[model samples]
Target chain A: MHADPKGVLTGVHFLDGDHACCEGTLAAGARFSAGYPITPSTEVVERFAWRIPTVGGIFIQMEDELAASIAIQGAVWGGAKAFTVTSGPGFSLMMEHIGYAAMTETPCVFVNVQRGGPSTGLPTLPAQADMMQARWGSHGDYAIIALCPNSPQECFDLTIQGFNLSEEFRVPVMMMLDECVGHMTEKVVIPEADQIEVTPRRYTKLPPEEFHLFEPREDLVPDMVKAGDGYRFHVTGLTHDERGYPSMNVETQDVQVRRLQDKLKPLANGRALCETENLDDAEVVVVSYGITSRVAQRAIQLARAQGIRAGKFRLISAWPFPEQRISDLAGRVKAFVVPEINLGQMVHEVARAAAGRAAVIPVSHAGGSVHNPDAILKAIVEAAR
Target chain B: MNQVTLEIPYEIPVDAHNPVEPFLRMDRMPHIWCPGCGIGTTVNCFTRALLDSKANLDKVAVVSGIGCTGRVAGYANLDSFHTTHGRALPFATGLKLANPELQVVVYSGDGDLFAIGGNHFIHAARRNMDLKVICVNNLTYAMTGGQTAPTTPDHVISATSPYGVFEPSFNLVALAEAAGASYVARWTTYHVKQLSRSMEEVLSKKGFCFIEVLSPCPTLYQRRNKMGDGLDAMKFYKQVSKIRHGAPTSECALTKSGEIVVGKFVDRDRPDYLELLRGQMTESLGDRYAEPEVSCSC
Candidate 1:
């Protein structure tokens, strides 16, 4: 389904990553947003608050990140596509309700423009340190979809994809952009509304009496019933049955929690969005995502000039790990060199997927800035040996 | 002990006039409330208000944070959301703003609303978000076994405050009034008729409306204090309660074993958060602003 044409800003323009993210959400049929101001991520909501009015959406600046996170879920339940944004500290605060959204199967998006962390490390600079936190910050065994955008252009493209994935899977999708990409200005080409396909909310077709909130279809995703629709359905953060009532038991817990994790498996398996180049006859593959991909590209070129056949594997969707593709390449290549803004985060996943089939080299950066090309080039050279 | 009753074709006839079943998830009964708990009385009054208001029940969405009273959302036979601890107000705000057509009601206990969620409560009221917030101020965290709450009266013994509460409690009436709530009221669970009437009044209000029902937690709060059962608490409310409509919120603070000031305190006209949003957008953006979509997608 296409987005509501009125919300789609159909012209190409020079925009920063933050502005592109706002336009992308509008083009994805998002009519509601709740947020708190945090550096790097603040520009996303700032642009949203100013521009949402013209397109007939509401942007609420909530009291804190906790409220902001849960507020987006409320909007989703109330029949509008919605999102929230934060940096690391605020993202830490939002962890509880992110799990709530997962348990309730509330389709929404979160934009976390990462900065140096553990604690408010570098607000003005970039880091991918929160990559692991984004996957497991919320204390539960639940899965979420996260996308990594390499530039302003990908920021626009992937944010729209984030909303589509959230709605399709009924999960809180994260668009993990770092401060560098969020503040970086570049040209973004936005297609007309006709070309932008958005997955609208899947409202239930059953009548109110027969509609079951947690009853899944063959794909394991249940249909939704929004508030004020005469479908007096109940939704909760507790272990619940198909009737949407709380049912506490080992059996119920297993069923409810397992579904939350398993519902996305089929969607995640063959659906890792990435850009690959020069893998055929390559001795080493450099795995990177987000801003690190740009830096890694330079390292690949440098390695090629030195007569090493180094391939590029750039991740667009960072979560669900893209394990199958990585594992296949692990046997084909002698080693995989992973670079990220963080100190050995996504590289661990890469190492796990390689499963000792290939030697995994992690070029860890302590995070305040991007990796130096020479450091990555040295790893590329050493890995090929 | 149960074999005789089970062997008998034992089924008591249902009360045909139990008007509350339609408003509650009857299949989930008998409820978790203690036999003499005042929470039931409060729920009864709320159910009465819902019945009398004649509002579109489908358009109403009830939300609650975690606690004994938070379970009210689960029991409510409306579009209900049972959310995390201390977050009902902001969650309800999202519902109201996303679809202005929803009659969003936040029902939770004092600990959930005033302790962990205190920031949200003050801000939601400050924004005057259009919501009907019915808070059951049982004075302690009853669900957690009589722990001291933000509304726990000074000198009251609780599981957390065995030496007696040294910190003074919040005057919720004054808090709500000062925070810019458009409507504020207080009553005990004993005041069923008046509580129900206040709820009806709040349902039609256009901004944040708070009703504090000083309910008795017979199992936890009452038993810990040796304050007799629910009946004694009702009798105490009848004896010490002073009906003072339009009283200043400051004068309505509850004292330990003192006069309970109860009445409708503040009612006024004001633009809700969403209303102000639309008006400001229209004034600045003029013809370019598209109104937010509010219909529920069925």
Candidate 2:
């Protein structure tokens, strides 16, 4: 554990992706973590359970994912930056509450280290199959923020980003990590405490009597006050009014749903939205995210070195589907390639974004192995020709 | 025995202003509950219990699973979570452990707790987690339009059991006591005052405490059983219940023909899971506990 003298992320060290993610959670100011241990994601809870107490925080092994998610929400409401880590099965268990978090507009982070599944498909293996589920698994027309990290460093960095997004938007942010990044060991720098920027939830500055839990601010995010603060507020899963009470009126539901959707839409147009590489003079754009993005990047580089005009757009925030960027790239490129571990989830989104400007082709795999860089490169070359 | 009407102090005001008025959307006031549903009674008892305990209002986290009783959290003026079906206990367990200072309560129905979440229910009790679990048993799944539940009597008819249910019902008090709940008690809606008092006592208890209230589901259980109304259900309780003090917790069971045994069945000391965890953490970390140890080693 030698520290680098240069001080540019000096404490960087090699650790499995899961441990790195755990460290990233702590770096992001997560003081309370509650989760039931599940395969491929258990290491994260184990790491946090051991690490949190040292920071004068709490970590609890809940009875299940339902408990874990609720506990994390409780911690967040208790004025702590809280998170829960789980995988496919656990994510399925957590979907109902995920909608609850959205409806309540609670600021919390859920790290779903993806594995294959509809139900416990591949417990210890990597799979990016939960992309759609992460965005729309919960029952409702609410907006969600989902980030996919391709490497251990990204796992550490994006978790911080996830917490930030959750706090900033006052929404539950999901760090959609997979087994590849979650288990692979890599060099990750743990920034100094002073170097990290941690954003706590916005508390109501108004008097307790005047505070409204669901009233949107100028930014569309509601002010949250912790429980036990003597502020009385209602929270429910049903479509609600400004005061957090359920209102079945269609107009109220429409207004409330739109705000939840719009609050996250602007994020897709901004800095942390998407990352593009070599798209200027490229004839083919290979779009991908998560571990598949790493392969896509390699594929594009290989194609570019071979004199084929190939570009890459790694989706950082996958949910509000980077339609504008993909549309822009489609006009510039002759074709678009989407390579993913799943059969054809993100490809549909890419196809929608590409529309008629570029021919979109899916390079998909749902096996034990990841989508290869060679296959993606071949797809790019074929499209270029 | 002194006929003492225990004063169950309530946190939410019962006055003209309506304590829940600020949180309640008055237009949505006519909730979905049938008239004389025990859910309202249970909700009243819960709010009163929270108030009597003087629990930190801001730190009170109420979580409920899907059921008629699960709506208790929706009506509360607190940090409430209306979670997925049968998973409220786990969520409450998490909430309690996350903020040990916060008062975490699990308000759920019999089906939510004993059927779908049965595994979590027993395990949470066995761990003796610091939580207040209020199980409102209406004998059937009233929310899904009258389905047979785990707590449904052996000869009860419902949507799933158009013919009378053949399975014997769970003895929740005995189940909780055996599972290691530090506090275990049972009371029917007929004993609302006693139920409220029992809830107050359980709320004040330090370890995992469970109170099973025999709430009446007039629209479902009552209607199906050919019981006329909520009053008829109360009459059945009055005629059948035999309060035997010092009765063994394991012996308490609810049967269609058997006497309803209602009372505080178990109360004893057990180290709560959180305190035990803290002790283990303090012992392991020792002086090196204040700051996080960065591990650069893979």
Candidate 3:
């Protein structure tokens, strides 16, 4: 589908990551958004409120994050591509609705401009501490897509992909941006409307009487109908049947929960987004993401100059972990050095994927800032030994 | 008092045929509401009102938050969403704003609306988003088993308030009026005839229209407080109710045994959210801004 011309800026301009993200959302055809402003993430919605009027979209500052989160789902069911933006404290409040969107299979995006936090630790600085929380924050068994953007340009580019993946999978997609990337100024190129590709909402062509709200097609994803489309369908947060009514049997629970997990299983490796460099004969591999990946590049160069064999692995998609690539590298490399802007989050996944075949070293930061290149270079040198 | 269109029949002719069945998911019944529960009656009145108002059923969508009355979304034969606890208003706000053509209705309970969802309730009304809200106030969180509710009158016995509810209850009518609802009414279940007529009037009106239906929870609220049964509550409404049309919202607070004011207190027109948004955008942004197309992505 062609992007809505009104929303597409269609030009190259110097913009912050937050402002670029708003442009990306507009180009993706999200006509509605509800949010409560939180730091670092606030600029995304602020820019949106200013530009959305020209594009004929609604940007509502809801009561709080909980209302913001659930409100977007309602807009989705009403036939609008919608999203919400928040930081850690707001993201924590939105966890239940994230699970609600997962359980009900609502297609939306949650942009978390992460900062240091156990609880509101550092609102002004950068941190990737919410990586694990983004994947497993919501209770119950469900998997969602999360993408990490390292630059203001990727903040615009990846947001388009995030919305696409969210629509394709019928699940909430997380745009994991740090406070640094969200605030940093850079040139962002927005493609023209015709050049920009959008996956339009897949509305069911089935008649109202024949439509079963939760009944999936052969693709294993059910087609959607908007509210007031005369479907008169019922959708609930409780464990529901194919008819979208609450059913408490063990059989129904198994079917419903299994489908939520199964739908994204294939996308784990097939649609996994990452960048790799010089891994063919590396003695040690560095796995990194977010702004840390940019810093890791410098570390890899420093290690190579010091007569150490090092390669770089930059993760663009943070969840549905690229286990296939990581596991394959575990057999070839002597060790894997994982550096993230948090205290050992994704390193656990790396360790699990490596499964004792190679030594896994975690370079943890207590957040509030990104890792120094030397600290990562030190870990790469140590892992190489 | 606002005019009730006398041309429209307030009650359904049950003897001729079941007019309400077509408006309900018949297979989903018998409903989960306990006997003597006022929700069933409210649902019936809602269905009748929808029919009487002559609104297009295809363009109506119902949204509900968690609690017993929240189940109305599931039972309604409409494009309905049973959303999260205390979030029906925002959900409806999202739906209504995104699809301005659709008639959005928020149907839920006191705890869902006034307690956990209170912030949304006030903000939505303050914005004057065009939505129809039907709140079944049973005085307690009946779904959670006789828990103290925001509408639980002082001195009422509840499971959470084992001795007695020492906290004062919310004056819902006052809250709605203060928060800037364009249409606000309060009626007990015993006034089904009047309540149904009120629904008929409110359904077609614009802006934030609210109807607080004082209901009875036979199993939890009544049984715990020794308020007899649902029948006793109905009789109690007849005894203590004062049919005061256009009463001041401040004096309309419900007490344990005080005379309950029941009538339409507010029904005046003002620019809704969408209207104000369009006006501001057209005035400020001018040629740069365009209104959204009606048949969006259809």
Candidate 4:
């Protein structure tokens, strides 16, 4: 489907990642947002608050992150594409609702502009520490889509993809941005409305009597209906049957929870977004995402300048981990040098996917700042040996 | 001793159907409420109000937080959401703002709405969002086995307060009024007709309207205390309750044994969140401000 022209800003402009993400939400046809202000991530909603009013939408500043997170789900069920933004502490507060969104299969977006944390570590600096939290912080065995954008342009581009994937899989999508990417200014060219593709919500056409709210189709995703549409559907956060009624038995739990993960199996390969280069001939691959991918690019170039054969595997969608592709490369590659702004978060996934088939080296950082390219270069050089 | 049959006072006719059955998920019944519980009674009043007010059942959505009363959303035959514990108000806020055409209602319990959800309640009321809030105040957390609640009166014995509660209790009607609700009222489940009428009244009200229904949690609350059963509590309400239509809310705080003040306290006009949003946006941005569309084309 084509993007709504009313929300698209068809022009070239120099913008930061936060502003670009806000524009992406507009072009993706999001008409409602609920947010609580937090450092580094606050600009995204600040821009949204100013931009959404003229674009014909509501940007509610909720009481706190708990309200902000669940409020967007309410908007989604009320028949609007919606999202919320937060940083580390706020993201921690939103974890329960993220689980709620997963349990109910409410399609929405949660943009986490990563800042340093265990608590309030660094408000103004960047970190990639939230990669694992985005996957497992919701306290359940549920699957979610998380996208890592490396630049302002990709921030605009991937955010739209985030919303689309969320609707397609009926799961919450996370647009993972670090403080560097969120704050750095860059040139972004926003295409015309028709050039952008958006996925409309899959509303059920079955009559009210026959429609069951949680009945999955062939793809294991149920078609959704809005509140006022007379379907009289019931949605809850409990383990429910296909009729959307609470059924608290082990059999129902097995059926319900399994489908939540099984539905996204298609994303592991066919829809996994990554930028790969030189992997066929290269023996050592530097795995990275977000801002680290840009830094790793220079290291890959420096390794190519020498005699060592080092490749680049930049992840665009970080979650679902692209394990199949990594496993395929693990057989041929000598070693995987994983560089990230955190203390070896995604690197563990790389090691697990490699499964002793090849050596895996983690170039970890404590993450008050981005990784130094030479540190990644040193890992690549050692792995090549 | 041989068992002697106690005479049954009333019987449901074999050919008759309940009037409120159409407004409920009959397949999900019989409900989970304990015997002599007042949550079901409040649901009956709500369904009656829906019928009497001629509300478009299709356009009404019920949102509830986690508690025994929170299960109201599950049995309600409308677009309903059984959301997370203590977050129903914000969820209902989003529902109402996203589709202004829908009538959003938040129905939950005392501990869910007043303790953990206290911030959301006060903020939602302060904004005057167009939501009908019905808090079934059972004075205890009945779902979790009779814990002391924010509304548990002083000196009341609860599972958590076996020594009798030493903390002060909240006056819910006073809280609602102070938080700037468009309409605020209090009633007990014993006042079924008046409760139904108040529910009907709020359906047409423009902004945030709160009705605190003092309900009997017979299994946990009444059993923990020396209060007999739901019937005895109903009789107690009938004996002590006095209706003062515009009484000062500050003086309506309930004691362990005191006159139960019940009436409408706050009813006045103020622009709701959407109205204020649109007005400010239109004033600042002029024609550039497009009023949000009520329904998505998709």
By lDDT, the best candidate is 4
Error of 2 at B154 (Å): 0.7
TM-score of each: 0.97, 0.90, 0.97, 0.98
Question: Fnat of candidate 4, please?
Answer: 0.76
lDDT of candidate 4 over A122-188, digit per residue (tens): 9989999999999999887999999999999998999999999999989999999999999989999
Name the regions of candidate 2 deviating beyond 4 angstroms: A1-10, B1-32, B43-61, B290-298
Residue by residue across A166-194, what tens digits does model 1's lDDT show? 98889999899999999999999988888
How many backbone clashes can be found in candidate 4?
0
Query: Candidate 2 vs candidate 3: which has greater lDDT?
Result: 3
Point out where model 3 deviates above 4 Å.
B1-16, B293-295
**Tens digits of per-residue lDDT for model 4, B137-225:** 99999999999999999999999999999999999999999999999999999999999999999999999999999988889988878
The segments of candidate 1 whose C-alpha lies over 4 angstroms from its true place after superposition are: B1-15, B294-298
lDDT of each: 0.90, 0.80, 0.90, 0.93
lDDT value for model 2: 0.80
Local accuracy of candidate 3 as per-residue lDDT tens digits, A1-385: 7887878898899999888888888888888889998998999999989888877778989989999998898888888899999998999999999999999999999999999898988989999999999999989999899999999999998999999988888899999999989998999998888998888777888898788988987767888888877888888999999999999899999999999988887777877899999998799999999899989999999999999999988889988899998999999899989999888999999999999999999999988888899999999988887
lDDT string for model 2 (B1-298, tens) is: 2334568686534454544454433545567789878787777666676667776667777888888988887777677777767877776765565456778888889999999989888988888988889898999999999998898888878889998999878889889888999998888888877887888887778999998888778898878778778877788888888776557977887876678998888889999986677677768877756532221110
The clash numbers for all candidates, in the given order, read: 0, 11, 1, 0
In candidate 4, stretches whose alpha carbon ends up further than 4 angstroms from where it belongs are: B1-15
User: What is every candidate's C-alpha DockQ against the true complex, given to 2 decimals?
Assistant: 0.65, 0.32, 0.56, 0.74
Model 4 Cα shift for residue B212 (angstroms): 0.3
Model 1 Cα shift for residue A59 (angstroms)? 0.9
What docking grade applies to model 2? acceptable
